[model samples]
Target: MASSSTLSRRSLLKVGGGLGLLAAASQITPAWATGKGTKVSVNSPEQLLSLSAVDLSQAIRGGSVSCSEVMTAYLDQIETYNPTYNAIVSLRDREQLMDEASRADTELQRGQYRGWMHGFPHAVKDLAATKGLKTSLGSPILKDWVPGHDAIFVERLREAGAIIIGKTNTPEFGLGSQTYNSVFGVTRNAYNPDLCAGGSSGGAAVAIATGMVPVADGSDMMGSLRNPAAYNNIIGFRPSQGLVPFGPTKEVFYQQLGYEGPMGRTVQDTAMLLSTMAGYDSRVPLSQKSNPTSFAGNLDTNTQGLKVAWLGDFNGYLATEPGVLDVCEQALKHFNTIGGTVEAVDMKYPMEEVWQTWLTLRHFLIAGIASGLYSKESNRALMKPEAIWEIEGGLELSAMDVYKASKARTSWYHALDKLFDTYDVVALPSAQLFPFSADTHWPKEINGRTMDTYHRWMEVVTPGTLSGCPVANVPAGFDSQGRPMGIQLIGRNKEDLKVLKIAHAYEQAAKLTQTNPTLVKS
Candidate 1:
């Protein structure tokens, strides 16, 4: 817990206060609530921390576990493990969080329930604007900056009665896949402290995997949600572009590449959080008008004849490291076991052209977002080379260049559409390689091919991102070195529930989420 206001006697006071408050509240337990009979049997901090987000939410709502106990359990868990892994940054003071938890308990006693996540302690990704909390996008330039208002998604989280405890770490300006920045150092992998935690959702995924937070909000432009979930052995869902209203920012319409999504240890928790985060907001012009609460509905579905197209390595166009494909292929077999047919599909469109289109649109967006900082010599000195490269690439493009890139993007979308016409979902490896060295920024080579750009190693994620479809990263089993990996299940546009249902069914069949890292216990 990195806090400026670390009180010497705070932990003892919090524990005593939480117990006193919970005991007093227990005397007046409501008849409608489950009281002490909830299915979750939490006898210790480890037991409480081990409960899934959905289970914890149910326990809190049923009056089985008071909010203060939940808060204290998480705070202690964070104190025990966060220093070693660096999964969470800019954490609020423990005493203040405990106070908020007590208030939540009082509200429940008065029958003022908020939502599914009522009283759940949550940490927003550092990229999103969290009112009154530090929104340092892991950059030293605005390290002390705090927003006065919340981002639209943050507003949703607060409205659902979640107590904002802290901000999860992210790459500076979310420019790269690996989560490291000059401001807060690096976030280590959940499975292994020495390996890289993929980002810019790296901290959020690690927090969920390590039980520091129940569920977290993360944004994805190029596999920010999927890659980290794959690396951490968790579930990350990237919903369709406009399903979650992104900004309530200056640039909303043109900047459609990046999207806000949910990541959790289970598919149900991810879908539940998505229900809270998504919906139509009049503030965002491009926001979809569908019912977001429907995502929280029952995920059970019959995939008896579902058609899945395995676009493995894009017919060998992508250069993957040794064992990634094998692990994902093994995971794909679970779909077959669940009565879905899997077939290897060849690419109808040229992959290189798709890559080129991604580069152009990404550069254009990055330049538009970061050009002001790039214009200043002092700021350029503080930025990473990859950020500079993106800005420069965007600066060099002309109107005609952007127009042509948009046309290419449309063609790629059509190509994906054609696939969806035949198959229910398209599958790919979430990452090209397993967890790599955290000291090294990004992989220079995969197998023998050199990566041309900082993000080219993660080009496998772009098709789902480019098509504005719903993509969920489901846990594929670990590699020989105990390094975890995941596979992406891409559904047709706006078919978020279909993707989640298949992911839940696949998760049940795979049984990989049952495995926990050693650090989670320690």
Candidate 2:
């Protein structure tokens, strides 16, 4: 087992005190509670819920707000809106959360502030283990599993004074992009209600979008964070792999493709959350020790002179929606306005080969972790068909296959490195299409092109995933049907802050973050 205690004093202080303190101190007043002491804006639940973490923090710090008030507001919204979305699978102890808020207020009175998240309520994805909370990961096999310990990220968030209010839904074992399982039914998009929230972090995005939580933590492997963020018109950031730790557990496959990241309604809040979440973890072999810099710091830097390469389409592998590309092109013009130059570039790598390689590696890892489920009579019926297929695929892979996949990944990384040599950032459409119908697993056709596999339609993310680059989904604009669209900004490895800076600049320039989803209470 990896040792949590192995974290250096520098890392501990960074996680426990540094950027976290700054984050805690910065709060934005809830839009609903401006000037008037009462008259809460339940009228615009979606707009109220849309307030970013930074906005909430600013609100709390202005002395016009209390932690309990924010918590109650969100809880009320959840009650009103989550029934249709089925986003929040399990809620935290409400009374305890209120108590924590009261204590935060007390601390403020004594001038002992916990930080930006001190009184803010947040939710963790069901896939994450939260101590004393039932973390089902949307699977029946773990229905009764209550972890005795919090995942490292969860503990870190708690220590930063974030209120743990609930667990959002996920697919069983996070095997699929759609957020539905026998355990939690289905998580729907907050914008359309009829569309599915892109999964496995679907519920987290929905929670943020629907006002259930101001911000939430989500894990991404195959577009879980980005897809959902795009679907819901929010911010989802996937930091470079190993920037956040993966374990003190036996799950090595998850350690590779899977990553715990932050999802929020705004980029600054996502940056603040990442500042709190990123740090050295002795328990996770891949976790990296970050420099003592706030993720939100240096965001004021101008994008002028920043070199960006735009991959408008991935060599025709995936079809692009016209509106999605239109918004992305408009966003690119902002880079030029700020003095940054944009160029069209071809990735030149064989995406089909890379897709197959990723599947082979993914199968091996998922199967290895789920090997025990292969038995015929160990209540193995609890597993989903997708999970079983992935596991069996992994079981069939040879050592040579794994070796070849790794080599291919190396080649792909080299190709990306060459591209980054000329560009500070890479821009792409976050998704090939806007939010599709919730009932369908994947769209049969998009932009007149038929997709053979549910996951194949989302191949645009492979470049970032395979390269382990820092990628963020920034809300671009809405499509014709009012569904949100996003543009992804990918930065060089370890330059997550740079990507965030660019995203923040664009967010401010576009002012898209100011828009809220149209909420319909069920």
Candidate 3:
């Protein structure tokens, strides 16, 4: 598979002529020819900015549009608004992107169209390497780092005919949930520029929410993917760990917790991206042995008889906002309305223990990957203090610490297994609050509860993370401030598609997809 960056370059070269055509069209035709005219009235910058991946895919497939046209519109939007949001770290070669899009159009004309993602523009989080594109991982120490090859997931996306536009920003080493670093500054939320876009997949979510791209690839470990999706009011799906190849190491203990998946404006688009991204890779030893299935197929499957267990508070570790529970509860009621059984369930576990175990395991794993950066002679000014702290924490962890944490993770999984036996799905607030100001990291205090760590505030997601369950974030509703919130639908182990189907069902019933960010012109 070609690297996303290579594919992006090829695309720009292929479509350069077509982009010239678009430019000429604008010169000769009305302003609407540039998508600037009032075919639709945009309420805010966000409304005009966000575009659904599925919609863009359909437009290209129907011949009503061309990939170059779509890419150009998005590039224009990024140029006009991205400076204020800092969502897109670097852009792909535009002429290269247009060239690849033209090829997609040629293929369509030749009856060689790929599926949903063909000709669709997308981005990957900066932490994921892309050959020829800077993969800084949000750390200044590796500011000039470029990968020799694309990450396996990026390869899959290119094979599916998706054009990789560029990379989004993230926290240094993806250590925190807020998208900020000394390397690329910070990625602010599309809904409110002063607020955070959420991280370490923050840039990906913001790009999708702000119309810079239709679909984006993001990796989630400790809610990096889900939190950002929730903050930006987009759909983010974290497939069952081994379902999407996350390789170079097969250790189920850590690999299962950190995996890359898809984020988009709608459930169908997210599922489409997931389908393209799934499948086994020999490099990922624990990868499942099965042909990748279409995640978008039969998504209208009825949920009438399904049993959904609603664990609202996760035994009270999560501090949910006032309307957060209400929005999710109302969404759950829709399941009942559709003939599904909804019941409250008790999820009893040692919350503090889980956090500690996760911290120990995560810190050790991250430090191990960054061990080379911590040499005595170079650690002085090269590494961020937080990165140093995490590395030191990892070095202090004995083998016994890893063993104990793994054991705790196993215990937690078993507890969840018992719960899954009684429920077809588990649901909860995607985050504890509506989108907060992007200016700060997750609130140190919420509802009068002091969160000791950045990850503590998002403890609600750890159950699924620890269990390795496939989870999807469905846009639930907005808070009083008009910021979006979502509900997480977690499937039984390996039942990834089923969870997506349920999310699709809820999406159809709620019609909440109509809500989009109002982009303010800078």
Candidate 4:
């Protein structure tokens, strides 16, 4: 068993001096938050370290703390922790970041508040290109590749006054569930440095978990955002399809599965980040005209009479680890305290078909994006095996396969629509297992069941991705091993607001987010 300690409710609050910042900003209890029966305690730096992106925004905007203070605090924490965690990579341009922060402070002094993200120093996932910063996509071929312009999401973040500190690590081409590549190495869990921080948003999640960033930019296709958030004990949301639009793409309508979204330590902070991300542009046909501002507004915490369907194991079909299921089940009971009803719902579908559909569609998009890179000898040599497999799988897909997968995806959406007709939300374990060894590759099995592919272990999230439903991963608690665990709050198609509201209510009831992980320095 892993060595661990328990954090009392009083000590958890004392770490942050209060719970206001974490309460709404995607909050959770880190495994090491305990002050007694443990070797570690929350130190003074953690006080500022625990503030959510929303709290930091308010504090910086309101002049409670200078931008330089916020910038230096996170940079100090990152410098202290990143060497061990390997969450952020390609560090450079700090002098520029310091200058921008000072300018932001000057602007604030003149009563010019840009927005919620004003003057905040944060990093984008290496998968997202940023101008002048090294955006490696975790691939060796792009090791020194710097984009001349920001990706759409990065552009939006900058527009909202977010300072791009650097890029977070990711799997090569964002191809796997684990954060690793030939470039930067694997990113470890914030709770335990030896355990895996779920990826390809792994670096982004760890960065936010350890105060490297208050909020971050992460993209999700197959649980990239949600899985890492679950592992890191933070909040990750995969908004409804078309809610966040990208640019300079040739295939918008056909390939909309992969999307860039926000990551934060709190839902309110996540929502605030989403406000800058969500917008409609004719350049991307799939863009939704959602009022992103609504996401940042007051979250409804009252769960009076909300019906929740506890679909543990997808009707006993998913091979979830016993301990993980237990944690999720315990979290479901918290719904009752918030006036939410829980009932077992047997999803009457062959669960494996969802995985099949996702594999086909996901590979098709990947192959399309990786089209010409393989032709170059240097690039082919730099490509990771999983990435090559994905590209090949996409290329091997037949027209019939595409047609069948598209039909299956449509059917899956209808099936979820039917399920939502009966219940407001469906709850399940975010990841099948808690954080595993960061030193190892993907788990080959779950509960003794062998996984067939490198990504098969992450099949649990495929349905949500396939259905295009809005899903949020909220921290449930921790496994006996002191690793993080979380529950997924899934809403109906495009019911993004309702999804967040239910997650907020559960967050309030669970009170897990109130605790944060204290780095157990060796």
Report the C-alpha lDDT of model 4 over 185-240, residue by residue, as the tens digit: 78888999989999889999999888888888899998998999999988999988
Against the true structure, candidate 3 reaches a TM-score of: 0.86
In terms of TM-score, the best-performing candidate is 1
Model 3 scores worst on lDDT over the 10 consecutive residues at: 16-25
lDDT of each: 0.86, 0.76, 0.75, 0.79
Best of the candidates, lDDT: 1
Estimate TM-scores for all models: 0.92, 0.87, 0.86, 0.90
Ranking by lDDT: 1, 4, 2, 3
Q: How far is 7's C-alpha from truth in model 4 (Å)?
A: 30
Model 2: CA > 4 A from native: 1-51, 251-254, 376-379, 447-450
Give the local distance difference test score of model 2.
0.76
Residues 469-489, model 1: lDDT tens digits: 999999999999999999999
Residue 129 Cα positional deviation in candidate 1, in Å, after optimal superposition: 0.1
